[model samples]
Target: MAGLRRGRRPDEQPPEVRMTTLPTGAELLRYVVLVTGVIIAPGADLALVLTSAVRGGRQGGLATTMGIVSGVFVWAALAGAGLAGVLVASATGYLMLRLAGAAYLLFLGIKFLAQSRSVAPPVDRTGGAGKARSFWSYFRRGWVADVMNPKMAVFYLAVLSNFLHPGDFLPGKVFFLALVHASIGLLWFSSISLAVGRSNILARNPRVRRMLNLAGGAVLVLLSIEVALPMQW
Candidate 1:
């Protein structure tokens, strides 16, 4: 065996080495599809976007969309920094985030429910005439809702690990995938916002608006309850 090994070329590579390259085109497509499915699934984020669009129109919905995307970038940065593992491993950290997120969702849901009963037209939360100020208000709500969810950190840590390999540059690849996720989210949610916002019939009809508010509020409240429950992860 020793003599045969010595006769072999020094430049010969092991089979394991063949698997260490960056994600192939097919792998990337698979990842994108997975991400899209996750984003499109009904969740607090979708509920929030629909409500914001109904209440504040396209600007509000787009602002909220940007906020959620920003949160996605933050999670990507955390993963790249290697902090996501710490979050996943720490029970206290996870519990605190879960509670805070649940509370925020509950509050938003109640507010929406209360507003649904009002006869007045939908108004921005800031009550300010400045478009920028109102935009920031909705934006901050979306950001807070996303950032408070511990599941995002867990998801990032879990999924990114599968895509990584030994000796590869971690941060760049993570960000690249994150960029794809964020781009898909932006496009998908923006389309939803525009479609909902441009509906003159829905906007003009109080009954329809009330029904949407009730639905959005109920979804948010149920999500909050779901989030508050103990997660197996």
Candidate 2:
């Protein structure tokens, strides 16, 4: 019954007071949209996608994007699967979770901003046929690349607070949130891919690729700043 620290936002009381009054589906929808929009906008994920585009070329960038989305899918899946307890009430618990989630995201963003790129592989006539990496290696790259990305965690936690309804079906809601988040990622990445398809503007210049990486790093730093700075509500 005691208020959790996370719920103790700048001024908002623990969820116990507000969640007792469940938000309407419309309100919930709005929250979901806000979360999705935030994810879609320029941030760590976008930056990383750019990095992939520059370093790995279009196909490699796309692979990295898929991996990024996949990571989000996993996080959402887990949140949805375990929603019964978190979303279903216990104001203290919800707030606590919120704070932890927020903190985690901020941590991820800062972490990524500080990360270094992996060593470049030697080019080959077949473009790595002789040295093709295994599926797991690619998978790992995608997963870790996105996972190490702190911006994603910040985005997930930040957006989640919007749609979460206390004392409701946790898995069901979190799953839906996941869908919204993942869908946005799909759209954003797809657009980048189209630009990548041009292959002329970005692909022609080696400098362009380096610039993209630098920009990506900058975006992530901003996302981290957004996450790390004090949050409202």
Candidate 3:
């Protein structure tokens, strides 16, 4: 014991991190439910997901869903961990992240708009089969995409903070919140997948697809503005 190193050595095995399971209150649950509903209520993330599902087939849509959910995980973690306050308060920090999110949303919106405008029937060249990216890669992409989204980060911080109490129980509350958020994300994304999996009616028609793309693009642009600009409302 006397000779043993106090700190973890480069090759030494790391201590196992304990994962605690804690219960939450109705208020927290309610917040989670409300946020889920809010997210479901017509926004760019959902729109892009639905469009991806419609155009790219099941995996593409699934990838987008996974990405979106991953984002929820990031946002929830940030909110729960106390980083959200700093993110929302500092003009420089907030603006930087906000702009990054806005740029991403804008790019996605423009890309979809371009896709919608193409004269030739758009190719689903997500590379016929063999070129499909790794499943994890897509999942990570979705998670990172949402994680980087400032609207969501700020939204959770400003709105969800009301339900959270400052105490030892906070960690537990955040965990529960993350679970609820992720579940909502999966539920919504799966619904899109099932709808597409069910029929070619909406997905196959160029007219419907164009509408979906344009609508999604518009929503994203709106979200971008909301993130980038100050809002009294």
Candidate 4:
């Protein structure tokens, strides 16, 4: 066929066709590593998971994890739509979101402190409407906690922006990145939940339970204060 393109086989392609523009394996690995680091870092999200696990057992922790994962995807969608940037750019919007998150955290901390003072009924370990209700309750808590936190919106905006291509399938790629992040979070938080669930010592010792509640509550209170303080985004 027109001299058969002397020096190249029929199946051979041009140098320009060597690879597609998609993310390479190395780049994907790097992204995974970076996301893993972010997932493992201590933050309000982790605190919420631990507290929920301790209070409600493995199911609670898992539910909360699901909620957080859902929130991550929501943020990703918002970022892909360019709404996250708009919110972050507006000081008043950011302020309101931050304050709302802080207020929720403060309320949770106060509840924990109050709980530490009194012996409430044992968490229902049976399966039924009660269990479903409890699971959804924790799920809502996790969802609200994540949604109210402006930091998450900013984080997704900053991180996902790096991998974005102006003309590519932007939302698909952004969601893929978020899925990676959420997968890491689910595994890590699930392990914590399992471990905390297995620790029956909390059920056995009131003092230890109170101590953990106090510690968890203190951490949330401190985080809330930190969140409320204005910072350069």
Candidate 5:
């Protein structure tokens, strides 16, 4: 047996395993469409963007979108590194994250509801003098809202995993996919911001503004409840 093995040529040795093929053009297109649809769907992210746009105009909305995208990038990195698996595996960790996220969402909803009942329209306190500071404030709010939500981590771990091919270059592929997702979010939110920002009629109408605030607040509260409850998805 040893003599026979030694006699075998190198070409007769087992072939090296190959990496999975990259997604084809059709697959890429399908991914883009699916991701875009998900971004445009109504959710906490959309509600936040709409509220920010109406209150702070285009810059505020854009800043918020940037914050959200930053959170997505972090999630992608964690998922690619397989660190997100830890969160999924640890019941205690997942529960803590979920509770924190729910509390934050509840706080936001209550604040919005309170504002809706106020006599004055929501004012941008930064005015013309503190544009930079105002931008950062909105950015932080957006980032916190996204990062606190354990669902985002789960989404990356669950959904993004399907797109990743088995290979040594998995991290690169995940990051690239995340970039695409972020790009779609930016474009969608920018359009919403621009549209809402330019609508002076909607902005000036106290009744309309109040209704929007109430709707947004209610939606947020419902989302929080959903997060708090155990659901199989």
Candidate 6:
């Protein structure tokens, strides 16, 4: 009777509490370094920035960078909401997006190839006629190129998934990460644009411009193929 009185009933047990862990400063630093390397790596994003810089000058390149950064935030928000994971998990969704991205990249590559054959000036020759229009054009191009890239979604799903904790405030952390990535991109692309824009040789040489267009176009097509291929992950 005394032992029975001392024992607690099953219904009287305490509820289990889940603990959330935030990323440590060291972890954050590591993430920043990793992200910076990725941003600076040779990819569609960097190629787009270089092309824009060569064609539209510093203002155009910066505008394009802004657009690309905006796309990053959009991706981060989607990832934070768990939408990116859903897309990645669903075979149909992943396939659809992958195909779309591949098609877009192919189109861009073809356009570049066509431009290489043209006799137009290396830079936009519209001058004051459609300055505002040109800026918006480059901005839209950047935004579309970044947004249509399924690789970004995969990156967030695969890479950030490891860095972020399920119990943590996901949206806040993702936004912070996105902002940091964008800041790095802006800094790097801005410098490239300034340097490219100041180069009279690149701006004046039609042959070099043609070669760049051909190279960029080829790289995009290759990237598209890479995207279209099935991954084991």
Best by TM-score: 1
Summing lDDT over every window of 10 consecutive residues in candidate 2, give the lowest-scoring window: 116-125
Give a tens-digit lDDT track for model 2, residues 67-168. Answer: 777887766664455442344345565454444544544544454344324333214335465324532343455666455444444455555666675575
* Per-model TM against the reference: 0.87, 0.56, 0.76, 0.86, 0.86, 0.83
Q: Compose the digit string of candidate 4's lDDT tens values, residues 1-233.
A: 65776578868876652323355587689888988887889988888898888778788889998998888888888998999999999989999999999999998888777777765534685879889899899999888998888889888878877777555677567777888888998899899889987887866776776777778888889889989985567
- What's the CA error at residue 181 for candidate 1, in Å? 0.6
- Model 4 scores a TM of 0.86
Better of 4 and 5 by TM-score: 4
Off by over 4 Å in 2: 1-28, 81-139, 148-169, 217-233
For each candidate, what is the lDDT? 0.86, 0.57, 0.71, 0.83, 0.80, 0.80
Displacement of the residue 72 alpha carbon in candidate 4, Å? 0.4
Ranking by lDDT: 1, 4, 5, 6, 3, 2
Give the alpha carbon lDDT tens digit for every residue of 113-180 in model 5: 87778646656666666888888988987888888888788878887767766553676678778888
- Quantify how close model 4 is to the true structure by its C-alpha RMSD in Å: 5.2
How does candidate 4 score on lDDT?
0.83
TM-score of 5: 0.86
Worst 10 residues of 3 by lDDT: 119-128
Clash count for each candidate, listed in order shown: 0, 8, 2, 0, 0, 0
Please provide, for model 1 over 83-129, each residue's C-alpha lDDT reduced to its tens digit, 9 standing for 90 to 100: 88887788898888888999999999998898789756766455456
Q: Judged by TM-score relative to the true structure, which candidate is superior, 1 or 6?
A: 1
For residue 134, give model 1's deviation from the true position in Å: 1.0
